[model samples]
Target: MSDQPAAAEPGRLTTREAAGRLGVKPETVYAYVSRGQLSSRRAPGGRGSTFDAAEVEALAARGARREPPLSGSDLAFRTGVTLIDPDAGHYYFRGVDATELAGRYGYEEVAEWLWTGTLRPGVRFTAPPEALEAGRRAAGALPVHSTAMDRLRAAAVAASAADPLRFDLSPDAVLRTARALIPALVGSLPAEGARDADADRLAQRLWRRLTAHEPDEGSLAVLEAALVLLIDHDLAASTLATRVAASARAHPYAVVSAGLGALEGPLHGAASGLAHRMLAEVLERGGAAPVVADHLRSGRRVPGLGHRLYRGEDPRAGALFALLDRVPAAGPALAAARDVVATTARHTDLYANVDLALAVLSVASGMRAEAGEALFAVARTAGWIAHALEEYAERPLRLRPRGQYTGPQPAQPLP
Candidate 1:
């Protein structure tokens, strides 16, 4: 036989050839493998990886078919509820500054205003006794190791089953459901301390479930502000899920359930828990430098330091940090959080986001790491309902988008 080596397989491409076909660096091709977006195999003699030519072509085609950047006129919906001004580093609910509303009013009052466009001073939300009982029972029945988010999901479903009028999608009915559901979601959690009086504000009631310590007025204020600040931001992932449910005319409870389902991932609602863990590590190590360094070394983002919509510090974080400054217990956690920001600032321009502020509250108050996630879910319930109401008025299923099929041809033979 001739000494010459065999030619490459007809259907395979080397790493460089694959990268060239995909119009990206060989490193990005490796990244695609790491992300499970593409597959590679060892080349003959184990010199380097080879990719299937057909797979590379398909990926390149998909990239070429990617849509252009969305404009205001493309897939935009009219909303009167919330507006975010990224340039100004501010957000508004009903055209009024969100921070102003959060500072001036309670969570219930702000929620009512967002729902009805009218504010009633001292407005309160109370769960019906029966609904609260059902929610608690369902939440309590979960496995012992179940997360707080799991209990919330269970409670939402139980609450829906208990509400016979849940199918009523009328505006008045949805408004009533919104009020009762928010409180029921809060009340379902097992209390860590003495049960709060029913007449207590929602924040006060929620405090008992989060920690055994009695809440001072300052800490309570911080919690209340956090609730109001988190009430809505603009079509967040969960809110969009809620809107899609509402567009299909699902009941308010189901809409909320959809939102809760979408809130489970770390990148969204559970982000605060990550921040809490990071801050706790910082406090334990007696400094932020080591913790930050470890995060960078491990290729993990230091959570709670950035917001896509804001150019500076998250306004919600600013509001909560201001209130936290007044509570003596928050001093150490707040300092640690500040240390994290300072330490990270040396490398990146990222500023503290609301997740960091929530972490400070949870750590200082001796609440579980999951406390911030619970606070986010309960507060954002109001926003979900508001979006539901908006979607209920729109043309049905307007949020649906057609998928572009990119798989093998339909006539392919069975394997």
Candidate 2:
């Protein structure tokens, strides 16, 4: 046999050539690209695209070697998560168009897509009877006149306490419980006796029932959009907390409670509320430009300006701001907030994360600043459920952390 290496294929192979090599049709190649299953680079002259032979071979090898089959963990490992991509220098959501989704889809649709593998065309949550009782119990446990979010958390805690079966961490049970509970979680918002629970009507009723004032069509639409956009983003700190609970084989509600505990911290769920309050403070003091400049000069970190991910812009912020634009900016507060954002953008690489934008949107929508954190918790519960589902499906063993011993060796027994 000749000792020479195989001859290099001429130029770049089209999709047809690449697919032919892979023993699949060209359409399959397009699908691969669409799902982010394959990578291709733009050509020098830009006629189409080129795929490296070595890269394709590596991908094929990886595909062949996949054991878990890249189901639940796909979003966690791939593009646009907490760590910004070194190549793209931005985050993405499951390779879906985050910008478009943020702009186009309501928050509910976005959330549904996050939880299930795909966005169902006309899916709805229908609650079971147990859910209504759970909802009533949850409502009573919350502090009177608390934020809507607080009531929801308290309800979740109460409902968990009420259910003996809740502690069971079986995957199917967890999902069933979540499906039964989420609508009630939302529905129980209007103070126990004031509202009645019927699972099918809970989401719709709660939307109208929770708001302190009547929601105009635009405001309601914006609120729905916010819910969708805030629904999930890979493994946030709270999501991680839920996963940890799941790893411990905690039930779904317990897992969510774990997530809520994490969210209570200032660095996580409370950040947006802080941002909202800070913006209000700035607006109250004078105007956005001066307050922002003073903040920068004083070395005070502006709330809602920086994020761990998204160097240029937070996709959620862009989506929210665009939605907010539909409403009139009638007062100094609106202009000031905008000015602060504009000025802050000039100095820092970080733009507003979801919290900052949510703060502004919440205020614009007439939600009390105190209640904003609770709303955020509600929005994020969807993600917690998604993570819990993944963890339950994987059936991970109990979480037991190993620690390096730093203390002195054991002494003799005490007298």
Candidate 3:
């Protein structure tokens, strides 16, 4: 749209050359431009267009950034995991909108979607009867103060022992075992047995295990939505650890163990539970301003307040809060959550994230103080397994990074 004649800049490419670089038809190149996925400028004589060669190449390579590696600092690695647009407060699971998917589906349905890139309904995740019994026995062996995550780790070991096909790496074999692990994990929690009638629904079963009370459909729906929302986020720290293990061709159980180890850290999966502890005080104090002021004054972060990815808002938090607002039993917790957000907004630019929503769910449902963390761990298993599958399809040990030597010279080269 320039008045003067347009001339191609050095290092840029004509339309045809851009298409060739991308290995796509010229029409496809135009489509990318139309969608703002790629940028192009008018060619010489104001005729066609010349695309930025670097932009076309980056698009072709999909996330390979040209930035130099910042050792022990921020990084961005190319991945084909779930796509998130935090500026828009939305994400997609393999191209499907996560909010839409969560609205109409349950956990395993979304899990299958993440794993196979297809939405198949009525899929069930259940293990053999004896396998559940084995997990229960393993969980029961843990001490009183041990966490639900500890019980899950113990149960994972027992279930691996029970599965004779645990080592099979075939796609079908891996998926079959993955399905079985979810149910076995659900049955492993330290809670009452499931009745025959409601045993078919994974959410219902998990509710019994976590709460030790009768399952309510509304709360179950909220849990399902949470699971779907948390299913897979691209290249999270725990997911990176999971892929590293999978790159070594470790079995799914071991991959899950690696993920659990990463999730145990306070900076990752445990943040939600910590938020719950802080929010519990809000519920008791009947106000959040004092709690927020105290946290800010102490130079401590308001737990579950904001996210690095989400610039405007967190869609996961929005989705979960919408569902929780409908449950009458969630009143007190929802009130406290509202206060937390309002108070934090006045003091800082931070907003509520998925962890805050998860903490709110814990308080409302009267689940254990640590239940938020356990829920995050359980929901993220779907993502961890999906990432493992993706890693297994790639060349092994592809995640190894070149370490820059920073220490004293290594003993003068072993002289």
Candidate 4:
């Protein structure tokens, strides 16, 4: 049998051509083959590989779609707090549609409902005078360069110290702690303007902390909706930490402390700040293309573009954006955000997540970049408490997972 070369296939593409069509390197094309994302055949001369042109185009069209990252543990806990239906592009809190709840109720009302399963209209949370004073003092003592989240952590510690009943794990005591602690967290931050009256809504008090601009009715509504939507989201990392603390019978304050600790990670609470900066840059640069290109060139995933849990737009984001549209001041920043989503969609199927919506609110309201993070921490305090209550009912220390040790054998001699 002769091994002479034959003419090239007309409908096929060489590795180089496929790379060009896919906007990637030939090496990446080979990687796709290894991962079974694409298939290739040996060329007629057996010297190189050839890909079907149709297949290459199809793979490129699929873009960056991927499965949600695994949490590395098989353990699951049953809870009635929140349900996220990714396929339906919606989430619910306690059997009620979360977006609808945000629309119809205030932050305090939703939070109260989540805690007790009873809807109390016109409910409000007030910071205890002693707890608020202690929190302010502790937060004020932090270095000048400390962030809003830093202040929140410091306040949590001091507030825990100020409460004589912090060690009480009873349901009623825990509820009292949550209500007072959330307001204390908000009050701890140095006010950016004249302090709001204690009787004001939580969103109004929080607004005073975030920006000096006077709050309009529309903007306050957006802030309230953000809080309601953020109240809980199934067991996030911080929620898990809060539950673990509760499993060990930690007091409500300490469980919240645990949650705040976990929330400080960049991949979690800090993500919105990154999105804020990105949106600002897009606005300054007068386009999303170059800013997005810079992020891609530096190998950074575009912030606020996607959520692992939602295959489409994050429901929380959708709800917030709908409200933001009514705020005239949000017009420019909102357009910038939309540009970011549209630009990224050219190469990937990602949709805007809650972080992006938060960035829009922060940017348009003249708030600092970290404002979104503070909002997340404050709102999620209620959720942490809800989970703590559930964990308190479970067997004590039930969350203690046995580690599968994969180190030196027990029989090994000490060095």
Candidate 5:
């Protein structure tokens, strides 16, 4: 909070020198100070701020870990949860490779791994019959024109209100609640008479609810892989919201509700549907070139083409796309996706991301238009739980960040 500049000393670097060390401009240097990541001091005689040389170097080292650096105005803060290495175009869940886990295990198995650091292969999520019935009633209470996510959100509130033990914040209790919540949310949607037809596996259960289509092996694989791949990433906006709620010791149900609320935003989980529409444009035009040119001319980004953390490639996209090959139904959409990615790569470094892959698979499988976003929300529920668990172990409310208070100055003392 010190505005006066630090006195020059052997161990201190001026603002300009610190900026050079971080490979950013002075404004960016100030941004770092504002985040409290780097300590700044008043310059002797009010010249300007200077920073501790060691602190600046340490931040530089952390920046190197992210390679090209995280975009979207987020600070390069550290977390013990997920490591998204853009340099290698890969991410890890608590030090283990995510793509490998997604390929080898179902979402249930991988989600358990993220939550407890051990994969529980045969473990499955199931809700009590009464709880599921309650969830369905809550979802049914929503107004017409409700999206699937809306139903999920409503179901969460109902589940929380009905549980007498919802206040428990212990790790074991949280995991127990999560175990019940995932299945409850899945079961709450409108179903085709046989609600439990594919009840043994989460993906097939969701497939029936999403499109009421009987399970196809290839399509099931695509949905399962999409779920596992989206289990966790770095602190996305939704995940951050979940953690902030957890920091206040909100119940597991409330924590997930916080995350799903953020996920509903068009810029986040809903983004996959937009990505699908963009590629549909390429199909209509018979080429990626014109679509790309038109999007650029309009000053809007070509959706789902790139990501901030993984500038080279999104590993989840690669993992999910691999499964699409066996899904012969997705053939045309896959072909169009390839054309768009290839064309975008040729023109700019922007590459296809997981959202683009999800959209393509959704289109190919003949699912509802909002199917991809639903899958994203379901998968990310695991991540929100993991983040909430981590936050629970920290001091309560530690996530409360200070504001710079640039609004109106102190109110006049008149009256």
Candidate 6:
């Protein structure tokens, strides 16, 4: 044999050839690229594009004939979770850490990072003149005087519906829609012209509008911390739902809708609601350890005490609890809640999940009972976009799956 290795069989493959090897159509291959599936770079001195045969082959092999049909939840559960460092945990928009970014950067900057995977060149927040004007107009359109949440939900639904391209799942369109719609939704709520009128001011400003009370620095800080902490958690149920839909090439709004539907359930994101209700019950029974003990003895699980992820203590809970130290009368409820948690932990491995701490924090800060869910909905939007972006990139198989037949088939049409 010659000393030189045998020539590799035409190492270079066009997109069409790569699609053929993968048993998918050319359009499907293009769909993948649009969704950020296969990595590509511009060919040197060429008009057409080129792909790495090795990379394409590896991706195909990994996707080959997997069982149970990949779903969003499956991907989420399988993808390794990077545990956030609670105290030092910083959310970077694209690359900038969130902790550093939140106070320094505007909400628009953060939103851009969440949607586009990175802050595009020259991304910065300037309070939109129209943002305040549009906010006032949107609020006026609502039923004269609605609750803070009413204004928020109305603005969001109306804005989303108005975006003709909201259904488009393509990377460029989704990012464009996000930039246009998100600021409108956040800004156009409650009448403007407040002491602080920066429509671009995110967490604190929004909190002020929602509460209809002067923003308490401590409470606002606590709320912001909660948002920052919970903004993303590895592949959560709702996040998975969004990803799965995105995999199917569903529209971005559709994908987000799927995730929101999943979140609306009691088991997933609504767990915080249960925690709040549980604490309310405890308060009604007199803020005493014995009352909590009796409730536990009666087979009622305290809502916020236990979590599925952290076996000992949830780091987010610890951070929030530490911050609440300065607030007045915030101690008793938290203490009683912790007492219940400790008592329950002796029997189960449950630790205080974020829900419990949030209930305490929100309630202590005097937010309306119904507001926590809305806050959670807002916070989770960040994660929803993150998952959507990933889906846009991966462009995995469609979400539809074959089902196991249990009952008789569609025969005997009219029995």
Most lDDT-accurate candidate: 4
What TM-score goes with each of the models? 0.82, 0.71, 0.79, 0.82, 0.78, 0.66
Over the full model, what C-alpha lDDT does candidate 5 score relative to the true structure? 0.78
Model 6, position 1: C-alpha lDDT score:
12
Please list the residue runs of candidate 5 whose C-alpha ends up more than 4 Å from where it truly belongs after superposition. 1-78, 192-194, 197-199, 413-415
The sequence of per-residue lDDT tens digits that candidate 5 reaches over residues 1-415 is 2333544678998877787788875545554543335656556775556788988899998982244644543334435567888999989876778888777899898777666544557668888776788899999998989989999999998888778899987555677788889989999988742557424778877877777556578888888888988888888999889988987899999999999999999888998888788777777888778987887788888778888887676899998888887887788888888888887776678888898899888777666667788888888898888777666655577676667887667776775
lDDT (C-alpha, whole model) for all candidates: 0.86, 0.62, 0.77, 0.87, 0.78, 0.58
The local lDDT score (0 to 100) that residue 267 gets in candidate 4 is 94
The C-alpha local distance difference test score for the whole of candidate 4 amounts to 0.87
So what's the TM-score on candidate 3?
0.79
- Residue clash pairs of candidate 3: none
Model 2 misplaced regions, further than 4 Å: 1-90, 145-149, 162-172, 191-210, 293-300, 329-334, 345-349, 412-415
Candidate 4 lDDT over residue span 308-376, tens digit each: 999999999999999999999999999999999999999889999999999999999999999999999
Q: Write the per-residue lDDT of candidate 6 for residues 1-415, one digit (tens) a residue.
A: 1111222235655655666777775444444543344544333443333456886788688873232554654433332112344444322333344445444444444555454333433353332444435545666687754654455455555565555556665455555555544455456655232545444345665575456655556767777676666666666787777778777777655665566567766676667767776676667776546655666689876677655555556766777787677666577668756766876766666778778887787566556565566566666666666566655545368455677889976766786
Candidate 1's TM-score: 0.82
Instruction: Sort the candidates on TM-score, descending order.
Output: 1, 4, 3, 5, 2, 6
Q: Sort the candidates on lDDT, descending order.
A: 4, 1, 5, 3, 2, 6
> Candidates 4 and 6: which is better by lDDT?
4
Task: Give one digit per residue, the lDDT tens place, for model 1 in 303-359.
Answer: 999998999999999989999999999999999999999999999999999999999
Candidate 3 wrong stretches, greater than 4 Å: 1-78, 192-199, 412-415
Candidate 2, 1-415: lDDT as tens digits: 1111233245445555566666654444443443345555544453334556765666667762243644544334322222335235444555565656655665555555554333544455655656667776767666667666566777787677767788665433554577666766776666322444343232344455444555566656656666666666667788878878876778888888888888888888788777778778776776667767777789888877766765666777777677777766423445656777777777766566777776776666565664457666767777677666556544356345567998777894775
Model 3 per-residue lDDT at 203: 75
lDDT computed for candidate 6? 0.58
Q: Could you tell me the TM-score of candidate 5? A: 0.78
